[model samples]
Target: MTEPKAIVSDLESFVAIAKQVIADTRDKKAIPGKLKPYLEQLIRHREWLDERFRQPNPDAFAVYTLHQEPDDSLLIMSAVFLPGQGTPVHDHAVWGLYGVMENQTEDTRYERIDDRSRPDYAELRVVDRRLVRQGEVMISYPPDQDIHRVVNTSDKPTLEIHVYGADLSKLRRRVYDPQTGRVKVIQARVPVN
Candidate 1:
């Protein structure tokens, strides 16, 4: 069996690298493609990524804010999900990158089939369901690839890191009811600790 790798003790460098990448991407005024490389780079930080999963919080999902641009240009956070815990089908208004840091998760991607002008009416179809493992990354942008749900299927707690084009906590996002085909506007909660 291969030996276990040492855990990373310093997260500062990793955060700095992410910040630089986001800044560069913004400077170029590019989205969608620019963040892919950044996500790949983050997934390569195995030790650092694993460090976020060390302690499992039994409360609501554990979320740690790593960095956020003053202008809301970018936001990076580390999220920990306990077993059987997950999110509702939701959409982020801006671009996003999700990277698995520990264990495994089920990511269900959806495609909207109705018009957005009628807020009370909406429809969605499952386009894909993926098993995202450590070192894997997923990208999503509004209008095309933004609606999805993430669930921690492992018995133990799972950790993941996310980078958003805007400060998610301040954005007005949407959550869809798969059965009723209704959409509701909601604000993302700010990460704690």
Candidate 2:
């Protein structure tokens, strides 16, 4: 059995390491060849984050702030989703990884298509849908690929660990309405502090 303190500590450690890697990658303007193997390894650790997210939470969503660097370049956060609680279709412009710390999360991906000329709003095509069970993870690279929505699909609340390569505070992310096909800018707030 893992203690809550230990799980939180581990997340903090990994966030620190990943932050350095992100900085190095930025400086090199490329992902270093030597880091490829470990990058994959880090992806594996993302699943480990699910354990901490499994801890109890009273609210529909709870965030545990593991790290908030001085420059706000990185943020390691955890969220708990009560049954049926979730965000609308949205996208993050920075790189991020999410792991199911407890239970399963159903997610759907969408592709954006602009129809600015018609004033009819943008079109979003469903790309994929899947249930991310415990120990499963997903990674998002911004700009090109980042639009999706996640929901808790089980009787019990779900937990998730989210690591962002950049601080997401007040960032304008796109939100889409599948039913209406409307696209709008929405601010992603750090609810956990």
Question: All predictions: root-mean-square deviation over Cα?
Answer: 6.0, 6.7
Alpha carbon deviation, residue 159, candidate 1 (Å): 1.0
Q: lDDT tens string, model 2, 1-193?
A: 1111222235555555565667657533232332333333443454455556455555556677667777777677778888877778887767777777568899888887764464336677888999988766677766546788888878998877676656675586677787887667766644211
| Model 1 agreement with the true structure over 1-193: per-residue lDDT tens digits | 0221232233565455545656656433345455555565566666664455445577667777777778887777888889987888888888888788678899999999877679766799999998999878888888788889888988977878787878887888888888988777888753221
lDDT of 2: 0.65
Off by over 4 Å in 2: 1-9, 27-59, 115-120, 190-193
Best by lDDT: 1
187 Cα displacement, candidate 2 (Å): 2.1
